[model samples]
Target: MAMKAIDPQYTADTKYALEVRNVDIYYSAFRAVKNCSFGMERNKITALIGPSGCGKSTVLRSLNRMNDLIAGARTEGEVLYRGQNLYDPDIDAVQVRRSIGMVFQKANPFPKSIYDNIAYGPRVNGWKGSKAEMDELVERALRGAVLWDEVKDDLKKSGLAISGGQQQRLCIARALAVEPEVILMDEPCSALDPISTLKIEELMFELRQRYSIVIVTHNMQQAARASDNTVFFLMDKEDRAGQIVEYGPTEQIFQSPKDERTEQYISGRFG
Candidate 1:
């Protein structure tokens, strides 16, 4: 099927930290997401919320070319990071991921020590520093994710040995270790308990002071509470391809959405 979007002409101004411009994602001939577009502001959180299989995660992964890791998966249109199209052939996907880091729905820590998990990215990215500098970096990252106090004495412990919530925070700290300009989270709290979820949300609030964040979440209340902007997606029944249906401030989206579909979904009328 030909690709299309509910808001096909969407654009972002210079103030945006990153922007998806009429992007379509596909695996082979199967289009997973239609021309979805939205902007993420610097030092702010933008949440992508929708029902299952609406391509919320697909779109989030596209920001850093994570989709490229899938066989035959490709993206169409522009994904601008610092004014450069990330899909361009000259762009390095590795560097893209390094700059725009990601945390998955599940906590996937490396089978290494907590300190090593945090050091891995920087090492791969050619970070050359003394032991003290590397140690400081690790401490800063753990503290940034709010995991230092709990795991400070356990830096030598295996990342997998930590609690699920702590493991997720460790994954987050791993992302921050490289000092990414933007963080893409695919339901970072979905696997955690309520308390853990709240901690992640609060950490997001604090992290936004230094990094731009884009989160794909199914939780409507979480989106309303944690994000400055929200984009609602819906699948086109005919094509089974997802598209952005509404995009605006979180308050407007929750209180007075311009689209009735957004209202119905958020109000628990239908997914």
Candidate 2:
């Protein structure tokens, strides 16, 4: 399906799930990404693609303030969600992260039982429900990630005992358990086999119906196939900071990119 054109400017009436305006990320003195701007539409999947050292992951991490965990990592400029600046002094980073959950490049499920893994987030966030209600919530989250049928009977098994793909899905389920409005995936399928990667792509489609998704991926084909919109980033040779080269509907970005650099990169001529 064709995606609507995104206006870089945000207004009170705009329908963007998240609007990143002039965002610059730095690790201490080195600016890693500069002046990045884009809007991720509600219920659509947006992919961030670039070669190595282009700050794709850095941009993704900033969406939920995950960068805050790294020493000396800081972000300047505004990331607006629901018309509020997420970087405001009054904003709570923990709540921001809860509302915009993340899945890492590698699946790092806690070393706990599958049930506990899915239940952990809600519990920490003050779940006041009976056992049956918690069970229902867990089931719903697992079903949302397309992993319910595969592991329904093994809820007591160690999360680490599952296959790599199942572990990834379990991690996704854990994120869903928190009922986030947006999901950020940083190469969630990078370590999976082809079939597992396809499963992850399919799960992404299902999840997009309810939550906005932003993914950072190096796989061009995956970006072309799975995303409604695409943002391409490249390093600025002058200062070695990453910046957006192009962003638009996936079809146009892949078929007729306006920038020659975009075309060259997409066609594998150069990074």
Q: In terms of TM-score, which candidate is strongest? A: 2
Cα lDDT of model 2 by residue, 102-148, tens digit: 99999999999999999999999999999999999999999999999
What is residue 156's positional error in candidate 1, in angstroms?
0.7
lDDT by residue for model 1 (1-271), tens: 3422222244446878888999999989999999888888889999999999999999999999999999999999999877788898777787788789999999999999999999999999999999999999999999999999999999999999999999999999999999988999999999899999999999999999999999999889999999999999999999999999999999999999999899999999998
The TM-score that candidate 2 achieves is 0.95
Backbone clash numbers for all candidates listed? 0, 0
lDDT of each: 0.92, 0.94
Top candidate (lDDT) = 2
